[model samples]
Target: MDTELLKTFLEVSRTRHFGRAAEALYLTQSAVSFRIRQLENQLGVNLFTRHRNNIRLTAAGEKLLPYAETLMNTWQAARKEVAHTSRHNEFSIGASASLWECLLNDWLGRLYQASSNLQFEARIAQRQSLVKQLHERQLDLLITTESPKMDEFSSQLLGHFTLALYAAEPAQMKADLNYLRLEWGPDFQQHEVGLLASDDVPSLTTSSAELARQQLSPLNGCTWLPMSWAKERGNLHAVADSATLSRPLYAIWLQNSDKQTQIRDILKTSVLD
Candidate 1:
């Protein structure tokens, strides 16, 4: 019934010596003995068998050991959960580095404009990491080019976009131009394999479109990038006869979350939809 009494009981049980337990608990030996007496009286059980110098638990005390441990664990967890809820109204979001570079940043900007008061944390990770975070409920939402196959999560078709090959200069000398591979996903990689020569592997490969663009913008190299990203910068033009690749973006969240309604509302009205 009394958590303090349980704490005293646990400490005394651990040390098996009243004086040692008191030292560990930063209390006087008399105070520790009084607590044990009070606990025994309340429970109507003699918890410990004390000889001249030896101490051992009684049968009733042994029976309560497991339950006391459980009670302490549950109490600590409750305190942590309550403190987290009281300290912050937080929304944690995660996505692949490619998605963040291509489109999710714009979506985040829009979300900030729509709900200025919303406190959110954004993480850029690989697809596997993001999916793991979602399953663990560490991430409230995930945005990605590919939807997860797991049924425990709900995904929505946020929008579709195109990726086109671009270069800082025209491909007059194809042999001289370096290629930067922007890793969108397996699907994009498979699609790209057919478009290049058998011997034409990339000079550099990057998971981020922004990083790819940074290299391409100055080096006159060719790389595929989202149309939205390409349009904003100058001195870049689509390579002649290059195929435009179409990709879909999805917003994924846990299916049975307590914040399900709030997440749906935000997704529905947010600019990402």
Candidate 2:
């Protein structure tokens, strides 16, 4: 199977338009169409439903999406491994955006300093997407708040972080201040339900703490943020009498990963502080 055809298929799926995919791929629209046709012919299934301007992946295409991503990632890793002339080992690590901001970003720098021979590719994504990539062998390690309960993977408790309600002003913490809810995971959700009033409805909800922080000042809203982050920025202050939540972070990786030695070495260097 031609990886180029798969690449074309992926781009088309992403953009949901042949012309746009062609433009992005730097190929003619006719060439993109031909590649899709070739891939469909080889697979004996229509990958997409074409209806004027509306294009969508068929059931087969939906099923093939992860496999295609895995294949492309594997191919890229293989090419990198083959092309490298040094003794360095390359590993891909993934974490959620909030986790990267609060924890993994600093840990990654320390990891590099500690393990000079190891090269890392860091990706920030939602936990579900990261888990999918880890399952598909696209990612060597994943850092997340929730540990996946799968037998094929091993989960280790990395550290814990405290989340506290913060606002630009103490007065803004009370009354009709816009409440921005950060999705910290299921545990935090349950804890939040207990902390907040039943009638209190969040003005906005998002997965990224950074996004919530960005919107906080202008709205004079209160949101749960990592204590470390809240302390760093002088503009934000902790809400008095607000409940502080402690969330555990975990490092997850496949149990039988080929990069076990390298992964182990990297894990040793990870420091949450």
Candidate 3:
């Protein structure tokens, strides 16, 4: 199938008029009609039903809409990735800001040691944005706390980390000690609500654990943090009953990707090891 025909079909679908689509594509109206006709002939179905000036997509056309757009976007992304590969063995990765600061830095070191010649592009985004980018083929790999249930993706365990409450001093039961709420997701919220006093409120709330860490000393506050991170700071100590909080990390990638074998090996040998 000619990609141009699909492109023209999408343009017509967007504008809902062949003449306007032709104008947008810099093609003659007749040429646009010819492409649509060619596509209709090849697919053995009428794409659009015409009634004078009013135009509407046939049932067959409506069915093909999503697939057509996906094909075009995938084609464009493949072309861009091919161009990148020609220049260098580039791998694009994305993760949450907290993950980047806590984990991805070490993973990058592992990547460099595995293949010094490989080029890397790393992005820090929330999990939702990372999933979107991964689906669009904009990111080759993701390091996240939870596995994506999408069929097109594959995930592997990257080990687990404990999230424990930490403060500038030893655990204190005082409500006025300046509590900072760290957003760790819904599970954390559910686990924490029962632990807090009914009228107690945090002095600060933030999504970034690093920000929480920075504020802990200044405000003389307490917040949940990964044990590995918290242990490094001498002034901070774990709060009472914080040992139960732990979550697994996952390394996810597009299933059956061109770099699947290489990524599998890299994750197994370098990062996970």
Note the Cα lDDT for every prediction shown: 0.80, 0.84, 0.80
The alpha-carbon lDDT assigned to residue 231 of candidate 2 equals 79
Model 3: CA > 4 A from native: 1-85, 174-176, 195-201, 270-273
- List ranges where model 2 is wrong by over 4 Å: 1-88, 171-175, 194-201
Q: How far is candidate 1 from the true structure (C-alpha RMSD, Å)?
A: 7.5
C-alpha displacement of 52 in model 1, angstroms? 32
Candidate 2 similarity to native, TM-score: 0.66
lDDT of 2 by residue, 1-273 (tens): 899999999999999999999999999999999999999999999999999989999999999999999999999998877777245667889987777776777888998889888778889887888889999998999888887789999988888889888887764444556778887776667766544578867878887877888888788788888888777766787876577888888889999988888878787875568
TM-score of each: 0.65, 0.66, 0.63
Name the lDDT of candidate 2: 0.84
Prediction-by-prediction clash tally: 0, 0, 0
- Pick out the ten consecutive residues of candidate 3 with the lowest summed lDDT: 264-273
What is the per-residue lDDT of model 3 for residues 46-93, given as tens digits with 9 covering 90 to 100? 999988768899999999999999999999999998988877888888
CA lDDT, candidate 2, residue 98: 77
- Model 1 TM-score, all chains together: 0.65
TM-score preference between candidates 1 and 2, better one: 2
Best model per TM-score: 2
By lDDT: ranked, best first: 2, 3, 1
